[model samples]
Target: MANHKSALKRARQSEEKRMRNRTVKTRIKNVVKEVRSAVAEGAKDTAAQDLNKAKSIIAKAAKKGVIHRKTASRKISRLAKHVNTLTA
Candidate 1:
């Protein structure tokens, strides 16, 4: 328990932030999964489209500090590479 009043307020704020962050992270994962499944199903065009959407969501999440920038970049790069190999 947070003993001080300020500490209690901080704890409350932290919990709210954690819940919000979790939702954003969950959305990011779902989008990424959509892209991955599209790729796995051998639908390059669909995968590409989904990747674009997922990338944007990831970038937004990263910008908001919900996820690391490098992680977002890496995910986009990897998905792009997979789609490339399929089309190539």
Candidate 2:
């Protein structure tokens, strides 16, 4: 238990932030998975659409501090490559 009042308040704030961050993180993962699955199934149109969606979600997550900017960029790059391979 936090002894100081400020510490307790901070703990509450941290909990709120954690839940928000977790939701963003989960959304990003789900979008990425959707892209991957579409690519794996050789659905070029669906994969492209999903990849764009995942890229947007990842960029948003990075902006929100839920994920690192470099991490998001790398993921976008890799997914784009995979989707491109399916098209080409």
Candidate 3:
């Protein structure tokens, strides 16, 4: 338990941030899964579209500090590579 008033306030803020971050992370996972499933089903066009959407969402997440920028770049790169493989 937070003993001081300031500590208690900080704890509350931390809890709120945690919940918000969790939701954003869950959204990221869902979007990534959508792209993966589209790719797995061999829907190249759909995968490409989904990848675009995912890229936007992930970039925004990184901008908001929900994820690291390099991590976002890596994820987008990997997903784009998979989509490109379908065309090759």
Candidate 4:
């Protein structure tokens, strides 16, 4: 219940931001899953490609303030490690 006009405007902006963030988060999840599946299927090239895409998306999310920088770095690291394991 935002009575003040400014408050109502802020609420609307918040909702819009929330929806945008959610979409970004969902995209991140899907990219990560795609990478994992490629790795599981032993498709090293596809996995590497997907990992690159995932890293970019995650870094962008961090830069946009949707996720923390360390979290993004950690995710990229872990995904890289998994992809490497598939090669080795």
**lDDT for each candidate structure:** 0.90, 0.92, 0.93, 0.97
lDDT of 3 by residue, 15-87 (tens): 9999998898898899999999998999988998999999999998999899999999999999899888889
Positional deviation of residue 20's Cα in model 3 after best superposition, in angstroms: 0.5
| TM-score order of candidates, top first | 4, 3, 2, 1
Estimated TM-score for each candidate:
0.94, 0.96, 0.96, 0.96
The CA-based lDDT of model 3 is what? 0.93
Candidate 4, pairs of clashing residues: none
Tens digits of per-residue lDDT for model 1, 1-88: 9999999999999999999999999998899889889988999889989988988999999999998999989988987887787788
Per-residue lDDT of model 4, residues 1-88, tens digit only: 8999999999999999999999999999999999999999999999999999999999999999999999999999999999999868
> Model 4 misses residue 18 by how many Å?
0.2
lDDT of 2 by residue, 1-88 (tens): 8989999999999999999999999998899899999988999999989988998999999998889999999999999998999967
Range of the 10 consecutive residues with the lowest summed lDDT in candidate 3 = 78-87
Model 4 lowest lDDT segment of ten: 79-88
**TM-score winner between candidates 1 and 4:** 4
Better of 1 and 3 by lDDT: 3
Cα lDDT for residue 36, model 1?
83
Give the runs in model 3 whose Cα sits over 4 Å from its true position. Answer: none
Once superposed on the true structure, which residue ranges of model 2 sit more than 4 Å away at CA?
A: none
User: So what's the TM-score on candidate 1?
Assistant: 0.94
